[model samples]
Target: MNELLTKLSECIEFGKINMASPYPPNMKGQEGADEITRKALEEGVNPQDILSLGLMPGMERIGVKFRENKVFVPQVLMSAKAMSTAMLHLKPHFLSGAAKQKGTFIIGTVLGDLHDIGKNLVGMMVEGNGYKVIDLGTDVNSEKFIDAAKENPDAVIGLSALLTTTMVNMEKIARDIKEAVPGTLVTIGGAPVNNDFCARIGADHYSPDPQGVVEFLNTKFA
Candidate 1:
């Protein structure tokens, strides 16, 4: 069972989606995350174990590589794709309450900022680490974020902005979310934002990369 879980982790780490996927040349034809996860479930592997052991570790590895510039967006996206393939099998268990999620995360690109690559990467990374991600997409407004926070009271909000012009929107959205739903945590990120901006805006956390976001969430909900 442990061996099976390790193999599943490798499949994610290398971006092996399925038996027929040809992204990584050396891993061709081997059982990928899609097949392995389904098989693990059939063979009585616990769904939660698959998430904590198989999926999270693989995502962590890729995220670190990305932070160090050892891997680029394509590799990270492929790893996320592989992890998502495995997630489809586990999602039913999650819905049935047989498996547990760490917490809920509501994410969006701040208003007037139509960028989604950073937002999407963070959402995928957060979801891969076992949080339920509610992606509000680009050009999201303060009211939309506040509403989502109200619906999921315990959820953490992540605001992303790639433009300096739109960063002011993030500050307002974070303040609005907190005022509308007291005690909700807000984490901010993007090219123009930093820890100082986070502190200035009264947001809870600031991470430079997806791994930093994942690590922050883990610390909060652990």
Candidate 2:
């Protein structure tokens, strides 16, 4: 069972989506995350174990690799796809209360930002790390974020901006959320955002990469 879990983690880390996926030349035709996760479940492995041992480790490895420039966006996206394939099998267990999540995360690409790649990457990374992510898609305004936070009171909010112009929107949204809902932690990220910007805008944190965001969430929840 441990062997299968290890193999499942390898499948995710290597971007093997299924037996037929051909992106990673060396891993061709091997049982990928999609198949291995189902097999592990059928073999009576606990869903939480598969999540923590198989999925999270793989994602962490890729996240670090991404931070180190060992891989790029296309590769990371493929790995995330592989991880999502495995997650589909575990999600029901999560919803049924048989498997536990670390916490809820509400995320958005603040209003005026149409770009979603960064937002999606962060969402997938957060989800892969065992947090339930509520992605309020691109051009998301403060009201939408507040509404989602109200529904999931303990959820941490992540605001992303790809453009310098959009960064101001993030500051506004953060202010609105804090004023309306005290104690709500707002984290910001983007190419243009930094710790100084975060502090100036009253945001709780700023991470340049998805892994940094995941680490912040882990510390906050822990």
Candidate 3:
């Protein structure tokens, strides 16, 4: 059983979606995340184990690789794809509370920023790490962020802005959420933002990559 779980983890790490997927050519035709996950569940492997042991480890490894520049966007995206594909078998368990999530994460691109690739990647990484991610999509503003924060008071908020001009809105959004929910945590990231900007905005954390966000969440919620 442990061996099966390990194989499932490998599938996610290598971007194998299924038996038919040809990605990561080295693993061509091997049973991928989609199949391994199902096999684990059918054999009565705990869904939570599938998440914690199988999925999270794979995600953490790929995330660290991404931060180190050992892997690029295409590789990370394929890994994310594999993770989501496996999640299909586990989603029902999560929804039914048979499996647990670490916490809630509210993510979006700040106002006037139409870019979603960064936001989506962060969402996928955070979600794969066991947090329930609520993506508010692009063009997000303070009002929308505040509302979501109120609705999920315990959730950590994440803001993304690819354009320098739009990065200013992160400050306002962070400030607004903190005011609306005095103890809420805010994390900011993007091409034009950094720890210096995060400090200036009073956001709780800033990460250059998805792995950094996952590590921050683990520390805060551990």
Candidate 4:
């Protein structure tokens, strides 16, 4: 709500990484998320406020834009970059218990699926929304997902698959997690996936875009 936090939010929304990055011409040469976040910390702004008030709003805006088709992958990736740059300063606070995360989210592309753009975007958006993301990367198997769930009992598991062939893997993984760790939440998404597929696979939730995932998690944790 303050000036510095407002500027930080604007920088994140506009994809301004620093004073030198020129991806968004209107914000060129202006102090960006990196600088403003660091300065905010130096000036004693609460790190939680920087995240909740500054970064989350920016990410939420772009997320809504993405869902409405007002923005595309490249633009969303840029905002994610700015968010990541700013998070560098806040990570320490999160680590030291000075700031709190909403929950843990374990995500991966189902086995035999090498695509990551969708998974990565979801992870970034979830992280921006205050969840700690444990990315298992692409081509992940059921055992790995089960192991992660076992370790983080309360964490939500997210499965992604771009290929229709690989989408079947999600069903197996979801069943594996439910059998191994009952009550664990599993959400699925990708080009070939839909709400019907999610229901068929016994997964808990499904969404077409990253924002939908964020909203699902928020409701789960709310």
Candidate 5:
């Protein structure tokens, strides 16, 4: 059983989607995350254990690799794809209350920014780490963010911006969220964002990488 779980983890870490997927070359023709995860469930392995011991470990390794620049966006996106495929099997368990998520996370690319690659990566990473991610997509505004936050009062908010011009909008959104929903945690990121900007904008946190966002949520909720 443990071996099966380990295989599942390897599938995610190496971006193996299924036996049919061949992108990773060496992992080709092997049962991948999609297959292994379903097999684990068939054998009666607890869903939560599959998530914690299998999926999370794989995602953590990939996250660290991404942060260290050992892997690039293409690799990370492949891993996210594998993870998301496996998650389809687990979603029912979550809905049935057999598994619980860490918390809700609302993420978006701030207004004036049409970039989505960075925002999508963060959403995938957060979701892989057990948070229920609600992606607002690109070109998001202050009102949309505040509305989502109000709907999910306990949720954390993440803002992404790839351009210096659009990054400034994070301040407005962050401030508005805080004003409309005091004590809400707002995290800002993207190429033009940093801890200094985060402070200046009155946002709660800033992280250059997706793993940092995961760690922040874990620490905040733990």
Candidate 6:
């Protein structure tokens, strides 16, 4: 069972979605995350154990690789795809209340920023790490964020921006959230953002990558 879990993690980390998948060339034609996850459940492995031992660890490894530049966007996207495939099995357990999530994460790309790849990546990573992610998609304004926060009071918020001009909207949204919900934790990210800008705007955190956001959430919620 442990061996199956380990193999599942490897499949997800390396982007092997299934037996016929040719990705990562070396892993082609082997049982991938899709097959291995089903096998684990059939073998009577606990869903929680499979999630903690298989999927989450694999995502954490790929996330660290991304942070260190050992991997790039395409690789991470593939990994996220594999992870999402595995999550299909786990989602039922989560919804049935047999599994509990760590927390809630509300995320969006700030207004005027139609870019969603970065925001989507962060949301996927956070969700893979056991948080329920409420994605607001791209071009979200302060009021939408505020409304989501009101709907999920304990949720942490994340903001994404891809352009220098659009980063100003992130600042405005952050300010609005903070003003309306005094203790809300707001995190900012994207190509044009930095720790300095986050501080200047009174946001709670700044991360350069999806992994950085995961780490910040872990630390704060730990």
lDDT of 6 by residue, 1-222 (tens): 499999988887888888887898999779888888999888888888888889888999999998899998899888888888988888898899877778899999999989999899899889877788999999999999999999999789999999999988888999999999889999999999898998999998999999888899988777
lDDT of model number 5 = 0.91
Candidate 1 weakest ten by summed lDDT: 1-10
Error of 2 at 65 (Å): 0.3
Residue pairs with backbone overlap in model 2: none
Q: What are the Cα lDDT values of the candidates? A: 0.93, 0.92, 0.91, 0.92, 0.91, 0.90
User: lDDT (0-100) at residue 139 of candidate 1?
Assistant: 96
Model 2 off-target regions past 4 Å? none
Indicate the TM-score of model 6: 0.96
Q: Write the per-residue lDDT of candidate 2 for residues 34-153, one digit (tens) a residue.
A: 999999999999999999999999999999999999999998898899999999999899889989999999999999999989989999889988899999999999999999989999
Residue 216 deviation, candidate 1, in Å?
0.6
Among all candidates shown, the one with the greatest lDDT: 1
lDDT by residue for model 3 (71-160), tens = 888988898999999998999999999999999999999999999998999999999899999999999989999899889978999999
CA lDDT for candidate 1? 0.93
Go through the candidates in order and give the clash count of each. 0, 0, 0, 0, 0, 0
User: Which of 5 and 6 is the better model by TM-score?
Assistant: 5
TM-score of each model, paired residue for residue:
0.98, 0.97, 0.97, 0.98, 0.97, 0.96
**What's the C-alpha lDDT at position 58 in model 6?**
90
What TM-score does prediction 3 earn?
A: 0.97
Instruction: State candidate 5's TM-score.
Output: 0.97
